[model samples]
Target: MNPKLRRRAAGHGGTFSRQDAVESGYTVSQVRERLRDGRWILLRRGFYAERSDSTDRPPWERETEAHRLAVHAAARALAGSAVVISHQSAVVLHGLPSWGLDLDLVHVTRTDRGHGRILAGTSHHVGELPASAVTSAEGLPATTVARAIIETSCAARYEAAVVLCDSGLRSGLVTRTDLTEMLGQMSGWPGTGTPLAAVAFADERSESVGETRLRVLLDTHGLPAPDLQVPFGTGPNEVVARVDFFFREYQVVVEFDGMLKYRDDAVGAVVREKHREDRLRSAGVLVVRVTWDDLDQPERVVHRIRQAFARAERAGMRRVHP
Candidate 1:
């Protein structure tokens, strides 16, 4: 690639437009030859992504990265237009978790008077994007994190909305107040209630998508709400352990083991977890571990938790302090 094209591609997540390539001293024929020779991967019409080795990453992560590249390409292509990346596309640009969101097409909202339309792989939404709601992510114009969360929540399902809202809150990129204010601006708009409900349901205490989903499961099953990130210790000024969810009434501690459950030393982590569980058991707290797979069996997981409550009662464990 020419120096100018390389710089442009690097700025836009390895993506470059045909015009960029041509201006960078590359002939149209050269661009076609590069694509034909596997040197350039076509992302969309008039756009291309430089192929790089991504074999070490998981398939889903690789796909998400590709979608991000496409988003950048779309942003660059529409630079002169009166639009900013919004909705799920904005969520991706903000580096938030986008669970259950449709990412096949890039999403953009027109700041001017334009009706919503789908052209090729781009979804153009017509909406009011105030100056406060607009921001730049990685040098590309997109919605602010708070506004993006509300837009995503409005466009996605409840669970997906909760996921985005939880992540947005946890990252400190957005606050509950920010979300509430954004929702206030969307009063009477279509699907505004969904985001309102999602914002109310969102908890920054949820540390992962799986944890957020698990919380939703408990609500869906009508299980008693558990305190989040509850701490336990034998003495004051020291916290021996912090659990994901704690049922004070039942003396049960539910630990969510998601992708970030164990970052290193798997064997040592398992041993340490076992020791921790033993300590909790000795302290009159029954442990119930939940995994990503366990979320798929919500009923079974709820049953197991209820059984733990019964076991705790049989053990005669009373209310304990941290």
Candidate 2:
């Protein structure tokens, strides 16, 4: 690779345009050869990402990094300065939690008047993007966290919207008050109600996307609301465990087991979690576990939890007052 091209690629988060490669003393053939030899990755037409050997990161994290790179490349390719990254694109840049979002398109908002358009995997949203609604992420112009969450929530499904809103609030990227204010500003707009509902349902205590999705699922199934991040076995100065979901009335605890928890030290984490459950069980607490696969079958998960609740009720398990 040309030295100048290498430096340019390094500066642009390991992604660069064909024009950049050519201007840095590389020919079109060279670029094609590098791509064919696994030295670079073709992100989209005219955009390329330098290949790296690191494979230790999770798939989601790697995909998010790629999305960030594509957003930057798209911003550089745009003709004018009116575009600011928005929606799920901005969410990736801001390091906010997201799931089931389209990663192929570079999403941007145009401050000028016009309809949003898609071209070459780039999505442009043209509307009133005031200065206050804009911010910088990774040195690229993008929407503020609160604005991004609102924009995403309006366009996303109920589960995805709740996850984004919950993540934004939990990460302190946006405050509850700021989200409410943003909703007020976007009042009467089409699809505003979805975002409003998502914000209302969002809780900052949701520590992961899975937890947020579970909360939505439980609500959708008409199950009673479970206290989030609830503590069990509390005394004057003692606390045995902090559970994911606690149903005091039913003496049941629901845990959304994300892969990250056991990704490292899987055996040890499982052993520790088993012991914790044993202690809870000894105290007459019914513990139920939900995994990613369980999330896919919402009905089954609901049924299992309901069964657990019924069993706890039949056993007359005494609730531990925290």
Candidate 3:
């Protein structure tokens, strides 16, 4: 048990490789003894994680952290001159949002023409990756933000793709113009249309993945495009509230109420939100609330929104001048 190695593993989400142990003056039997004594946990064939007693973190957070360390370890093991991290792994490395991606596998792209293959726990993509499409992050070769988003969206589901694109745009990791140019460069390539559509639909004003996914659901269901982050007030300097989605034609506001909104001060949040809704209602604006669970049923969500829209339409000719 070298203290330096222990510190390194602690910094790396409690994960270390067999090579790390060996280089730190630990023998094979010593590693086995640590595992047997519950001082360490074997994460994979040659990787080990330090045992911890803390249970404050959620299981998913702990698991994802371990997976990230494994990916980095696999990258070090598969070191190659042409290997550049891409796709979901690149997204993780860049600290970008991704939905429904497999974090268990390390994804890399080779800057040469060859067939993509999965070896051990690493997936290698083979294609022509221009120099501009590659960059370095945290001492690892990885795709640039725009290129990473393009590659990721090409392989992700529509909802996932749109979420990633929106996140990239919102974070300023990639620009809409850059994504559009990347789409043009990827034209005629396999799986380009989906990313193209994602880029076209992406909006930086979307504050979270839930909002982006909700927008996608609305568009997919043929609902009229609602103005995002619409401010409600009688005058420019007297802004009363800014809403998630606003349909001026129907005088409706659709909000995606993510769990985080109430996770911290539930009572205070409820009071503030209730007052906001009341103010909007008093202004003759119908308010519709959606949650993550509601997103699971797109049809039902759209139906409820449509009902709200109809109610607003039939409730006389009152309007709130924004």
The lDDT values for all models are 0.87, 0.85, 0.81
Instruction: Residues 134-216, candidate 2: write the lDDT tens digits.
Output: 99998788899998888887877878888888998888888999999999887877788888999999999999999998999
Off by over 4 Å in 2: 1-6, 22-25, 53-59, 234-236, 318-322
Worst 10 residues of 1 by lDDT: 258-267
For every model shown, what is its TM-score relative to the native structure?
Answer: 0.90, 0.91, 0.87
As for lDDT, the candidate ahead, 1 or 2, is 1
lDDT (Cα, tens digit) per residue for candidate 3, span 218-281:
9999998999998887554776688999987888899899876786799999999998888777
Candidate 3 Cα lDDT to native? 0.81
RMSD of every candidate to native, in Å, equals 2.7, 2.5, 3.2
Q: Which stretches of candidate 1 lie over 4 Å from their true place?
A: 1-5, 19-39, 56-60, 318-322
Ranking 1 against 2 by TM-score, winner: 2
Winning candidate number (lDDT): 1
In model 3, which range of ten residues has the least summed lDDT? 54-63
Residues 1-322 of candidate 1 have per-residue lDDT tens digits of: 8788899889887899999999999999999999999989998899998888888665556777888998988887787999999888889888997678888999999988788999868999997778989999988888999888888788688998999999988999989999999889888888888899999999999998889999999898998899999989867776679899999888899999875456567788889888988887766688999998899899999999989988887878755557
| TM-score for predicted model 1 compared with the true structure | 0.90
Question: What TM-score does model 3 achieve against the real structure?
Answer: 0.87
What residue pairs clash in candidate 3, if any at all? none
Question: What residue runs in model 3 are displaced by over 4 Å at the alpha carbon?
Answer: 1-3, 10-15, 22-30, 33-44, 51-64, 112-115, 234-237, 317-322
What is candidate 1's CA lDDT for residue 232? Answer: 91
Task: Provide the clashing-pair count of each candidate structure.
Answer: 0, 0, 0
